[model samples]
Each structure stands twice: as C-alpha cells, then as structure tokens.
Target: MILTRAEELCRERGVQFTALRREVLEAVAASEPPPGAYDIAERLSRPGRRVAPVSVYRALDFLMELGLVHRIASRNAFVPCAHAHGIGENVVFLICRTCGGIDETTSPEVESGLGKTLKRAGFTPAHSILEVEGDCGACRDKARGAG
Candidate 1:
C-alpha cells in the first residue's frame, strides 16, 4: 500500500491511523486510474460494507497531510503520490490527457530554473502544478496506427 510509509509516519507521530484509513489508501493505490472520492465511497459502500462520503473525505484529507496521496485539481480526483515518504519540497504530476495516465517525477532542475524567474519578478513561489497534458506513448502509437 502507499500508506506503508504513512503508517510508519503515524507511528512516529503518535497518531492513530486506523484500518479504514489503510483501506481508503489502498483503494486509491489499487485503481487502474486514480479514483475520485465518490468512486472510492462507492467501492467502500458495496454490498455489506460501507463508508460515508464524509468519512472517506476526512480520511483523504488526513492522507493528504501525511503525503500519502495527491489531489488532481484538473480532474477533481486523487492518486497515491509516487514518493510517499520522500523528503522533497513538493512532488509534481504530469498528467496525460489521452490515456488518463499520471507520471510522478521530481524536478530539481525545474525548481532552480523557475526559482530564478520568480526571484526576478520579486514574487516568491510556494506551490505549483507543473502538470502538462499530452498523449502518452501508447496513445500516440494507437493514433498513428489509426491514421
């Protein structure tokens, strides 16, 4: 699960991370594509078991603080961050429009490059998206074949 490290973190921080929290974390990590809160709530609510939307949302918020997950503002969805426990300023996600795939990569070079521009403008940057939308390799190949 993505929350393996998060669980360890909870232990270190003396926070009570519950089984429901782990379930919610795993639900996101297990999705072929990242799942929205509604989707996750539906999954958890199937048949005999259930978790409310508020419960799911609360768990998601807690997970976000722990850096176990990331919310995609463009899609209104969430996914497990690649570096669940890594020590970095912020992780950037490159989202693919065609295939709905997400690639998580760090950019020290980008940080330095953009940092220079921000400093020049006298504006200090705190957070950024760095999300680019484009066709992934598989989708590009498919498009080539179709054409």
Candidate 2:
C-alpha cells in the first residue's frame, strides 16, 4: 500500500521514484526497529559491491520529502511512516526506551493548540513531528511481572 501510494505521489509530483528509493523504503519498512543510513547501506551491500552511505542518505532525503518515511532524530534512524499525513499535521512518535520500539499517533487538539500558540508568538514552524520517550505497554507489563 505504501509503495503504491509513494509511486502515485511521485507521479503526481513529477518526481522519479527510482529503484534504489524503492529498495530503501522496503528495507526501512521491513526493519523491526528503525535503521540508520549506514545500517541500511550495509544491509543492501552485495559480496563484491558495496552500497554507499551517500546514496542511502540521498534516497532517505527523497523519501522524507515525499513523507514516505520520517527521521527519528534522537536515534539517528529512519522509519517508514504508515500514515499519510497532510501539511501541518501533528504526528507524535511514542518511543519506547526499554524495548526500542516506536508507535505513531496524531492529535488534532495538539495541532490546534500549538498552532494558536505559535500564531500568538509570531512563530512559524518548519516541521511538526514530535518524539516522546518512555517504556511501552508490553515492556512495562513484563517489567512488572519480573518485579
């Protein structure tokens, strides 16, 4: 679904979704945890041929521009975003410290309130993805059981 949507978006925007971009997106989607550019490059490398980090970074940049993937700055990794968000939408990434997992959700209230506040302060924001770090439900439950 994501691949199809990405392709459609690329066509609509007059952008070329190259084979390398598709492969990079596939690798990111398949990862359990988000993967870094170097990690992805290493994974895609063949026996004799090596995938360059610069190439992976370029692919990542393109995917991010199209909103097919997002960068988790804290972890220095990229994750395939399942949701198709619009402009100025607020996406919150719930990052689990214990299990190293990430879950994404959106809040209209947050967007509305933040938008109002930023407006009042005469501030214009470039990006809106928020990352909150904590232990996830399964990890918390497991820790309690162990306790």
Candidate 3:
C-alpha cells in the first residue's frame, strides 16, 4: 500500500518512481528506527548487487521531495511518513532518546496554534516539523525495573 501510494504520488507529480527509488524507499520503511543514507545503502547491498551511497542519497532526496519519507534532523536519519499523501498536515515526531524509537502523530490544535503564531510574526511557513526527544514508555518501565 505504501509503495502504491508513492507510485501514485510520483505519477501525479510527473516524476518517475524508478526502481532505485523504490528500493531505497523500501529500505527506509523497513528500518525500525530511521536509518542514515550509508545504512540504507549497506542494507541494499547483497551477494550479487551493490547499492552505492550516492545512489541512496539521490533516492532519499527524491522520496523526501515526494513526501514519502521524512528526515529526522536530530538523528540524521530518514523515516517513512505515515500519511504520505497528507503532506499538508503538520507532523510531530516523538523520538525515544534511550531506544531510538520514533512515534509519528498529528494534532490540528497544535498546528492551528503554531500557524496563528507564525502568521502574527509575519512568517509564512513552508513546512512544520516538531520533534520531541524523550524516553519512551517501555524505556521508562525498563528503568524502573532495573532500579
């Protein structure tokens, strides 16, 4: 379903979703904790085929442009967007500092408040990405157990 959505988006944008792009996107989606370009390239490499770092970076750029993937700046890694076609919506990522886990969510109230504030400040936002770094519930529970 994700791949199909990506294909549809590419068609709508008049961009070709080449095989390398698809593979790179798949590699990003398959990772639990978003991965960097080098990690993606390493994953794509196999017994007979080798995926170059440059190719992965190029594909990542294309996927990000299409809103099929998002780069977590703090982690320098890329993760697949949950709502790929809903690019207009604001996304917030909750990143677990201890376990490197990420939870993606959206809240209209948050977006509205931020939008209003930005508008008042004469700032026209291109994209809004909120990343909160903290310990996840499981990590907290594990800490409690160990203590």
Candidate 4:
C-alpha cells in the first residue's frame, strides 16, 4: 500500500519513482527508530549490491520532497509518514528521548491556531515541523520501575 501510494504520488507529480528511491523509502519505513542516510545505506548494502551514502541521501531528499518520508531534524533521521497521502503543514512529531521512539500526530485545533498566528504575523509559512521530545509510555514505565 505504501509503495502503491508512492507510485501514485510520483505519477501525479510527473516524477519518476526510481528503484533507488523505492529502496530508500522501504528502508526508512522498516526502521524501528527512524534511520539516517548513512544508516539507510548500510541497511540496503549486501554482498553483491553496495549502497552509497550519497545515493541514500539523494533518495532521502526525493522521498522527503514527495512526502513519502520525513526528516526528524532533532535526531537527524528519516521516518515514513503514517499517512501515505502525505504529511501536511500541521503535523507534529512526538519523540521519546528515552528510547528513541517517534509518533506522528496532528491536531486540528493546533493547526488552526498556528495558521491564525502565522496570518497575524504576516508570514507565509512554507512548512511547519513541530517536534515535541519526551519519554514514551514504556520508557516512563521503566523509569517508574527503576525508581
């Protein structure tokens, strides 16, 4: 389903979903706690086939542009969007500092509030990446147990 959505998006945008791009997207989606470009390259590499850092970076850039993936700036990693249709400007990333977990969420009220604030400031926002870092439920539970 994700691959099909990616292909559909590429067709709609008149872009080519090359093999490398597809591989990169799959790598990112399969990652447990997201993965950096170098990590993606390493994961895709095998005995006969070698994936380069530059190639992975290029693929990541393309995937990000197409909204098939998102770069978590705080962690310097890329993760697949929960919504294949693409993440909109109002998306939020909840990052767990304890275990490196990430959850993508969106709130309509937050989006409307941000839009109003931007409008008032006379700023035309191109993209909004709101990342909230904290401990996830399991991590918190572990902390409590340790305490």
Q: How do the predictions measure up, each by TM-score?
A: 0.88, 0.92, 0.88, 0.88
| Residue-level lDDT tens digits of model 1 in 16-79 | 8998898899999888678899899988887787789899999999888877888888888898
Residue 102 shift from truth in candidate 1, angstroms: 1.3
Lowest lDDT 10-mer window, candidate 4? 82-91
Q: State the lDDT of candidate 3 residue by residue for 1-147, as single tens digits.
A: 789999988888899999999999998889977889999999999999999999999998888877888889888999998875466568889899998988888888898899899999999898767899999899999999999
**Where in model 3 is the C-alpha error above 4 Å?**
none
Tens-place lDDT per residue, model 2, 65-87, is 88889899889989888698873
Pull out the clashing pairs in model 4: none
Instruction: For candidate 1, list the clashing residue pairs, or say none.
Output: none
2 versus 3: better TM-score goes to: 2
- Indicate which candidate wins on lDDT: 2
If ranked by lDDT, best first, what sequence of candidates would result?
A: 2, 3, 4, 1
lDDT-wise, the better of 1 and 2 is: 2
Q: Report each candidate's C-alpha RMSD, comma-separated, in the order given.
A: 1.9, 1.4, 1.8, 1.8
lDDT of 4 by residue, 1-147 (tens): 679999989999899999999999898889888888899999999999999999998888888887778889888989888775444556889999888989988888988998899999999988888999998899999999999
C-alpha lDDT of all candidate models, in order: 0.82, 0.89, 0.88, 0.87
For model 1, the stretches where C-alpha displacement exceeds 4 angstroms are 84-88
Pairing residues by index, what is the TM-score of model 4? 0.88
